[model samples]
Structure formats: C-alpha cells, structure tokens
Target: MPRTALFVEIPGVLIAAWAPDLLLPNVGIALRRLRQRNVPVIAVTDHPPVEADEFPDFTERLQRAILEVGGELAGVYAALPDKPASWRKPRPGMLLAAARELEIDLPTSWLVGTDNADAHAAAQAGLAGVVLVEGVDPPTEELGIVVATARDLCDAPRVMIPRQGGCWHDHPQR
Candidate 1:
C-alpha cells in the first residue's frame, strides 16, 4: 500500500514572516502533531533564481528553522522558476516530484498552504484534501476547490486525518 504524506508550503504557510519569531505558534503545533502521528511532512518551495537572497540551500535552512520551532519535517523540496510549470506552485509538478521521490500516494495525501495555488496544486495532484491558512482570500473562480480552510496554521492538523485522510469543506471562510 502506498503511504500518505503531508506536503507543506514554506513562506506564507510555514514562516509567515521573516523575523525573530518566524514560526507561528499554531504552525508549530500542526507540525509537531503531524510528526507525532508519524506523518511524513515534506516542505516544498519555489526557487526564484533571480532573487539573490533565495537559492537551492534555502529549503534545508527553512526546514531547520521550522525544527527549531517544534516542527519536525521529513524533508524539503524546491522547484526552480526556470523549470517546467509542474515544478512551481499553482502547478502540481513540485508536489508530484516530492510524491514520486517519497513514494507517497497522491490521492491520499494532504497539503497545508496559505493560498489557492496550494489548493490548486493539491487538487491537480489529486491529493485527498487541503488546509489553506486564513488571511489571503484569493478569487474562487481562479481556484479549483479549497477542500478545507484554517484560520491559522494551528487549525491545519485538526482538519487533516493522517491515517484515513480528511474531510472536504467546499466553502472556505476566515
């Protein structure tokens, strides 16, 4: 049987801001709970090649930063801008790669992101559902379907069922 995994986004989802307190409290709770459940949470991000501040090594560093905040990650993956659409957010490429390399079942996985791009990517990848952190209200017409919504990162774990998968909430609200 193929195992289910949790695919998480970095910037907005994990570290909401770049400051001394980068990780949100609920975000840490979500990561720690998922870790306790033995769910493989792989952090994914896009590498803006033109950005002198961002690089290939940022993913690993982001993972370490998350760990310091009580979020233990299984691994981290990145998609370069120069790569195919599948490699970037709003597309399933990066998620697909992580699923393939990690041996995860797309139809049984979950994604915790802050925008519809994350939701779209999960839907495109055929993931069971998604937990979109509240605050950013992207156009619904532009999004596929937001399986679930979290007021903050902390609500993610409550919405996702690691073993049997999770339920779907078509209507997303703050």
Candidate 2:
C-alpha cells in the first residue's frame, strides 16, 4: 500500500511527513516557491483543545518554523471547527472557508495533504488542484489528476486559475 503522509501547514509549522518515518525530499523547493510568490498560507486545522488565543501564537510560531524549514508565508488563518464539518479534511469546508476568508481564488489555491481526505476535500470545494502525498491509498483512478508525488509537489507544475487571472506554475507540469 502507498505510504501515508501529512502535508499540512499546522499551527506549529509547515510540515510534510510520510507514514513510518517518510518525509518529503523537495520540501525545501516548495517552501522557497511559496516565499518567492508571497502567497498567503493559512493552516485550516482541526482545532486544538487549547484556548482560542493560544492558536494565534501557535500560528505565528508555525509560520516561523516554516520559514526556518524554508517555507514562505504571507499569513495564517488557523481556523478551528466545532465538529466534523466542511472545515475538516475530505470535506473541503476548511479549504473553501479559508479561501473565502482570505479573499483568495479557489482555482489558484492548492491543497497539499497526505490523505485522500485532503484530496477529496480539495476536489469537493473545486479548488485549483489537490496533491496527495505518501500514506494515502492509491486513488482508484477516479480522483482528479495526480499533480505530483509528496517529494515534488512544489516543484511540479502549478495549476493556474484562469478565471482569476495569474500564473501559479513555477515549474514544469508533472
């Protein structure tokens, strides 16, 4: 089975991990690209059991860590959900809600996550693209196009949002 990976901009840092100790090799490239573009990145995560204000600090720290880890960030939303709703992975609620709140174009935005839940959520919301990383089961060929492997998501071709009007692809198409 395919390895399970987690590609998430969490409250503590921009992280990408594969099951059983796998990690993204090209994470540096992705971070550099994100910084170069100056795009706003938010971590739409399952709310921690901590106080509300604590997340802001966590978000800031995570942003710093992403930079330390070679990630660029314009900002972070770090929104929390009360239950398993659209804001959670596989539902597209979190991505869609974040995009709307951030005033970003859905098609221009990309969701890089490890599980099929993330891909499903990205697709459900009609985002520009979704990249599934290691750990998730191999899609039965019913999901949208596979943009890249976990190690090469940032270096792969970027999906552009024509309706919004901008070039997002910084590398060759996969």
Candidate 3:
C-alpha cells in the first residue's frame, strides 16, 4: 500500500501568522505527537503575492517556525506568487507535487487547513478528506472533502480522530 502522509497548512494550522513567531497554542505538542507515531508530516503553504519567485526567507522562516514549535517535517512545499496557478491554493498542484515527491497515497492521506481554499485543494487533489481548523459550525456541506472540524490544531485529534482512520493523519501507528 502507498504510504499515507499528513499535509499541514502553515499560517493557520501551525502558526497564527506569516512570521515564525506566532505558532498556535499547543500545535507544537500535537505535531510532536504525530512524529512520535511515525507519521510523515509535510508542510504546504501559499504566500501572498510578491515580485520575486517567492517571498524572501519564506522557506527559512517556515522551517525555523516549525522547529521552534517542537515539530518536524518530512518535507516542505510552498506555492510561490510567481509560480504557476496550479501551485496555489484552490488548486491541486502543490499538494500533488508533495505527494509525488514523497510517494504519498493521496486517497488515504489527509490535510489540515483553515480555509475554504484548503478544502477545495485537498478535494481536487484526491485526498481522502480535510480537517478544517476554522470553519462554519456545520461545514460539511461547504465542501465534500471536509470530513471534520476542530477549534484549532490542538483540538483535532480529540474532536475527530478517536480511532485510526477517523480523521486527519488517520493512519495506523507505524
């Protein structure tokens, strides 16, 4: 079977802002827990429009941010402003690229994000589902891919992932 992976969107899921300093409360603990289980976590992000290929220091900042929060990543992929449309959110390119690079099985993988674009992209990319960290009270109808919602990244597992395959990063412990 193709290995399942976890795609965590930056800004909202991990950090509350674009900078490396604002990691959401308890996200660091949650991310570290995932690593202890051997789940390969990947970071995927989209930056605001910029004149260059990417926002200066975005990759470096992202890495420092994750590491600072006690989390680790199997890989990192960012959709640059100057990159093709397919690489941006509301599209499947970045996720697809990460999946291909990591040999991930999209249909069994999961994405945790905070926007409608995140849900749309995960669905388009064929991921099994999405955990909307911030969304409507009853968000299921908004996107076919949104399988659950949590108050924040810290609450995801308890809210939806009660058992293996129940929600985001729903793979058996390796």
Number of the top-ranking candidate, with lDDT as the measure: 3
Counting only residues 3 or more apart in sequence or on different chains, how many pairs clash (N, Cα, C under 3 Å) in candidate 3?
0
Model with the higher TM-score, candidate 1 or 3: 3
Name the best candidate (by TM-score).
3
| Candidate 2 residue pairs in backbone clash | 3-134, 3-135, 4-134, 4-135, 5-134, 12-62, 86-93, 87-94
On residues 1-174, what C-alpha lDDT tens digit does candidate 2 reach at each position?
111112354422234322212224565576666556655555555544245657666556656656776765544544464444556666766665556555656644566655566667767776655555443454554655334334345533353333344555332232
Poorest lDDT segment (10 consecutive residues) of candidate 3: 47-56
TM-score each candidate.
Answer: 0.76, 0.63, 0.80
The best-first sequence of candidates by TM-score reads: 3, 1, 2
**What is the clash count for each candidate, in the order shown?**
1, 8, 0
Task: Mark the regions of model 1 whose C-alpha exceeds 4 Å error after superposition.
Answer: 47-57, 138-146, 161-174
- How many residue pairs of model 1 clash at the backbone? 1
Q: Please list all clashing residue pairs in model 1, or write none if there are none.
A: 86-93
